[model samples]
Target: MNPSSDDTMHTLLIRPKAGRLLFSLLCSLLFTLPAHAQEADTARVKELQGVEVVGRHVTGKLRHDSLGGMSLDLSFLDDMPRIAGNADPIRYTQLLPSVQTSSELDAGLYVQGCDNAHNGVSINGVQLYDIQHILGIFSVFNPSHYSRLQFAGSAFTASAANRLGGFIDMQRPDTLAGRVKGELSVGLISSQGTLRLPLGGKSELILSGRGAYINLLYGRWLKVEESAIRYSFCDANVTWLYRPDARNTLWLDFYGGNDRMDYQEDGENYDARLGWGNRMVSMNWEWKRRGLTLRQTAYMTRYGNRFSIERPDFRLRMPSGITDYGYRLSLRRGRWTAGTDWTLHSIRPQQPETEGERQTTTLSATRRHSTEGSLWADCRFAVARNMELLGGLRANVYTIRRSAFFSADPVLSLLWTSGYGQFRLTANVKHQYLFRTGLSAVNLPTDFWLPADERLRPQYAYGLSAEYRTDLIPGRLQLSAGLYYKRLCHQTEYIGTPFELIYGDYDYRKNLISGKGENYGLDLMIEKRTGRLTGWMSYSLGRALRRYPGRFSGTFPAGHERIHEFNAVATWKAGRRWSFGATLVWAGGTPFTPPSYFYLQNGNLLSQFGDYNSGRLSTYIRLDVSATCRIKVHGGRESGLNFSVYNANCRHNDLFWRLKFNNGQYYYAPLRPLPKKLPFLPSINYYIKF
Candidate 1:
């Protein structure tokens, strides 16, 4: 049971004689995983001729999990192994195992219990609270017309409602049949293109765009010392569909994103140009009379981030914004599914000059309003014919206005399946009123940004999960294991109140406090998706701890608590037209604080963090490689020539947290230095379709 398939080993170093790139890598290595249904309704009409639905992956209507816990499927990408923009589906879920990718195309992913606003993102289904387009490292949907991807951890199901450890769902793509497919790309780290058309008939039209420049490719290493940084970003999407017939349907979605950063510093060593962004719009509808089946959706979102930091002497300006909207309805009855959703939020953080400010300076800003609601039910029955049963339930209501707070969260689940795999038990009581702000002292953004409290009182969690799936060999061994325990009542962070004083870059004075936190985890998977050498090996063991009591390192162990994670990937098929792939990652040392000691206040220098993740750094592994070559510039087969090589071990590995005032000795800054090793980077690409 070791199929480990991916990029299905296509080898054709340089073809000429025919054999068509070795039959397109054996039809993309005939995908492996997710087939059992009596090997798909009786081995496909006894072998083709009048049956269709095997565009790879052993046949598909789409639904996969070759032992890759927390499922995601877009027909499972024809047979996997396709990475070249559109955040490669969040970089293939960062090769799983508690996910990790703080930057380098960041969506701030550091999942192993959670943090980064505590996981929650959705697309076609709505709900997308700050999916980030930049300034937090990439992600804001643009996977060139995706079509379903889901991830849920921390006891979720009951239709996954309001906050707690994990959730990501994306859906879009199914343009009334086909025709008009597109893909255009350029790279240094950013560039994308997608288009699909087919309107009339049942209705359809799709468009996508993406952009990034980091000052046009690093802009000479951000100018160091002189302290110059430049950034740029963008995202756009449009979708429309109205199927007047065929049961009934209506859908419309528009998305937007923006990010800008310009900086200069030398003498006063500080200047600024900053901007933040997010915008969303959505609508969904569907109906199937009689037997009953319905779906209705709604969405609206807005987010703004503004900043100003200068220094002739010193100056700061901060502006923040937030807006949210929601609605939901779902009914299926039969397999069962009933739903509901309501979300409302408003947040504005404003900074009103901190008087004479200096002693190492620290400023303050905050404004907020909140409301959250949820109702859920989802089910799938059938206890025999191979086994099946999936349950659900959800209820959440949270609010905070000025200082009067409120919260109520409830969630539950049950899963059990036969077909050689599947077992589940989940429970949740999640909640999170609001949080995110503060990290200057080198965390950059030149100090100024706060918002948490319209009375932020909603931090609840009582989770438990037990999941298992197995198949160590029938069509190839695939395995998944999950165990989680969550117990958290309240958690928020940021402290220093004395009137919100934040003197000098290091003067960190006065009050800036917020409290509560906890997380627990364990998830593992082993995959070999079929023949010609496949890929996948993962591991994750987690814990996130935090409890603030007033300040000065009140309680710690939450900076994306990481305690061992490993990943391995491989690809082969070097015969017909040449194909190659490789990946390796290992983690175990993520918790940092090296600023030693400092004191100055008023003008800033009050950093004294000796605890909280106590310091650990020395475990990270890297190795990446890709090679593709196929010849055929006509009709189908995607018209040849594609080559890629990234970090083939350029292995500089360190992207921690930096702040080492050098000789001036502000020391305690380090993040972005994985130079323990390096080498290998080559790229070449070409693809044409007509």
Candidate 2:
């Protein structure tokens, strides 16, 4: 029996050759038939019903594409309340379900109980060590330059390795623009602009610049009551894209930024100048054809910090930095991908110089050389009708001086999909050869990078997690929950004074104590996606602990650990031109170590230390609100004005506590917050796009 009309049409849709043949036959019949016959045939042919196709895409604040990865849509930043009139990526990242930050005044992603140094950050596939400015108030990445952020917590791609915690990848699109465009923004503390020019049909270029005149705006207020202080920062970016054809593309990216602070003691006789910066340039090329893809990247990056002090008796200069040259190559076809990465690191731990009346002396003038290489491969395949598996392996080699170390890490993820929701189970092992150490409790530019050698072993982490997500309201509301446990090995804690660690000429390795750590947590989140009022609420319950077998004793709370954290973010679109946003964050305070007692020793007062990380600070609470108005101009242009208030409740959330010895007694108290003159800040920003 012949198929019905609908069945025949379905077959034709499935078989392109049959559809093409039928189309050709119809054309020939129209051309050969007589006019009356053609008219009669056309009148008899029936019109087909319209067909519609729909596809799924990710939207909203958080996305779960991979087993243990979450991607954030950059557009959300535009509608959220910003700090100091600046939309910050790092600050928003800390609001993710399982993510944690050191403190309000700090800018570091402490994911899964791992420290900031354990996380990896890359821009256009190039590694960046220092990605912060203004004492962590802002990230180096401008909101206008990028559109998305990918974070891999447990299961990451093969191309991103060498990190024990999470990996953040921010890639700029390499495509030709259809027209010229530009964006300009002016805020209370800084100003930034970006311009994109189409250099013909196949090439495009982007330029961006940002400058912060904090001293110009708050110089008098920033100064201590008895001291003189000034600060400034600036950065520039350039990106070039060439797409000769559909199969080949190339990109060149360059970024450079510098931060400087000058301080003079009011009554003392010493003046100091501190500066730090980052410079990087990278080139990437890709080729794709017929289900196969190839990519290659080469880059160079440098981060340096310098501190100088001048006094009546002598002058001192201390400098430390790290420079890297790296290359990466990757290829993919179907469900398999493989890559190789290699980098050469040149580290200057510290080279201090002191000048007297007649001569200049230099200390620790040695540069450590290290090399790291890795080969990795990954594949994804279906194991059952509703189950799939993703697995990968990485082989790493590290060499510093004459010593070498090797490790093999594995990643596995299993996924099961059902009508109700999706569930994922993931396991991963990662390692880090570079270590970041500093004396400050916060993330400061003075922190330096160190290589793993014979004395200091590489750090490694093993983690296991299970997560489930579902659409509670089918396209409007969603819910996700995850539970994870991570174990860390060969962790190191610094046990030396700042002067000794940064200037004194001692075996620095001896000051480091090796230990182990464990982190376990539960993360839950619910989000509203499609509505005029959209937002997400998240809660995290976690514990991070460390055990130093020799130095202190048993396990203790990690400095950045928070036992309970809750966050809610919402944005309301009142109309086409007006919108409002608000964010609320509340969390338990982290742990600290305080002095137990004080006594007179050798004619000097000394204090016996208490248990490590035994003291907990008070709870932290913050609320922010913002309102924005946008106006449409000619030629589809847009102009906007935004007003933001940080710490709207005027709460006194302390950054940290310091030990104070007064009246022959020892105690600990909260230190003065940043922007000492102002407990809260309200800012305005004006922006335009054409």
Candidate 3:
């Protein structure tokens, strides 16, 4: 986007808000060095070896943990064990507080009892609608190209509107100055590739791609026929920097992704394909002119998804997508920051649900649409040397065929530095106007299988949190702890589904569901990073509940509610030749269906779930270990091998709860209640870098 036009209009439009202008200028000045400063940062004493410092995050004092647990990267791989080679990012995040995740293959992440759909996830500001990968063993993005990742569990600014759980902000590394670097790897699930280019020294482009062959690798009985099952995806990101001089730099970033899956079953050949690629182009120009400092960021993110299925007898095409365009104009001077934020988002979920009784061939499609606009102002101030205060509010209005939704999300923050540690407190509330179903989710298993309700009301959540950060050994070791309380209302959930909507609801232009929810939880983490022995330990405890449609009553226990979860990761490094790491995670199971004789309810056999997760499943345990060895190649090129084993002990943890007779037997046979474990698969990855 060419931001100059908007910048000029913004300056003129805000000419009357003189007080805000002064405040912004004051805040920018506080982040700048004094006129007489001769040193940049004293910490740049040594050239980091194979270790890269992350970005200069804005809220450094707000978090106390040593980095690894928050956002993983390449350096931490030094001693980690490799299980074949997939480390699911969604599972990795569940180690935090109030987080409850399903089995290993479950792409769904329930935070503090919130449903899977409640969580908001994005890459470089581009929201990811489809999160499942290879039956849920991994994330959609290729891990090889990940940069810096930040996750906030509860309420955030208006930018995070629809979610009940938290916000995940992933930032890619800035384009390297004069290096052309890239990496390629081959693994069990897919073939992966990445390339980082200098782009003639002015800008850089980093692109990555992955293709999976699980359908071909493990075909069902249909494999005997003209069988088919294959999936693949790719992502590209480009960062352009304009550094005409020191103290002034402009940045433009763009990113996109595409994925698809094809399969055929029974004696029939059918194809199911999901595709969505977004373009997020942004430009941020920062400069300090005279005594005033200005930083303006203007960008737009557009996302869309299309699902199409085909067979010899039928054709189904459903497309639903969203386009979001927004910009943040912030000015900081002295100890104050003031800005305005505006955005426009439009969505169209196209689905078709026309069908006749399926004797053999079946096809269906559907859609829904919503558009919204918002405006807001943010303000911050340094009240004292180590204390600060911040506040903001956003007002948004939606346009739809039914009644429109209006909201005003508010944000408040405070920071204090004491002799013991730094305390950060934040109070946030948001009202989200989201469809019970989103079109962007079409590619995943969860997407359009449900129906849509245009009469639904907006959802709301209020969250308050207090966090503390302190250095145990100054810059070496760190510790952090925090408490959170949240209240949610008006969320949606799915109920009974007819067979016609299941296999037939191929076009996700509409969603079918009916239910509401409410929940809250607490979070905590600690870590150590300095020498070769660098890793961290984390623990989370919280709960969330729901009330979905039921024949017996109103709403009941949600499917995602879990009680406790914990994780411990540590590594030891011996010289440059060897390093070993181990990770352990334990969590209580969630509410699920139990087995019992059915009783007539509403003239239909309705078996009770038995105390909503009253039955405990087997505890989960896994040990992952990996070894790293490097050798020099020609032209000073270096290559290494990473071998990892996941679920090293191969414990059969419960994947899903099943039913059995009260006498410990099956409905009519001798089979007793049994717990199913997700299969453990190990992978080896070979990588060559240039």
| lDDT of candidate 2 over 1-690, digit per residue (tens) | 112110111111224555565666678678666656555545554333333333333235666674567777787877778787787887888878888855655778888788888988888778888788777877888767765888876545555669888888776754566899888989988998888899999998999999998878777776543477788889898999999999999999899999898888664567889899999999999999999999999999999999888878768777889999999999999999999999999999855687756456778568999999999999999999778898999999999888999999898889888776788898888889999886667777777789999988999988899988876766667788999999999998877664452335545576778899999999999987656888899999999899999788878988889999998888898998998999888999888887787676554456677888898878888888999889766786889998898888788777777754444555567864545556677889998988
Find the candidate with the highest TM-score and give its number: 2
**Two-way TM-score contest, 2 vs 3, winner:** 2
What are the lDDT figures for the candidates, one per model? 0.60, 0.80, 0.56
Q: Which stretches of candidate 2 lie over 4 Å from their true place?
A: 1-61, 223-228, 264-272, 309-316, 351-361, 499-506, 598-606, 660-667, 674-677
Among all candidates shown, the one with the greatest lDDT: 2
Q: Specify the poorest-scoring 10-residue window by lDDT in model 3.
A: 2-11
Instruction: Give TM-scores for every candidate, taking all chains together and pairing residue i with residue i.
Output: 0.29, 0.89, 0.73
What root-mean-square deviation over C-alphas does model 1 reach? 23.8
Over 184-264, each residue of candidate 3 has an lDDT whose tens digit, in order, gives 767665567677777665566667666665545544421212345556555566566665655676767666666566665
Candidate 2 global lDDT? 0.80
Ranking by TM-score: 2, 3, 1
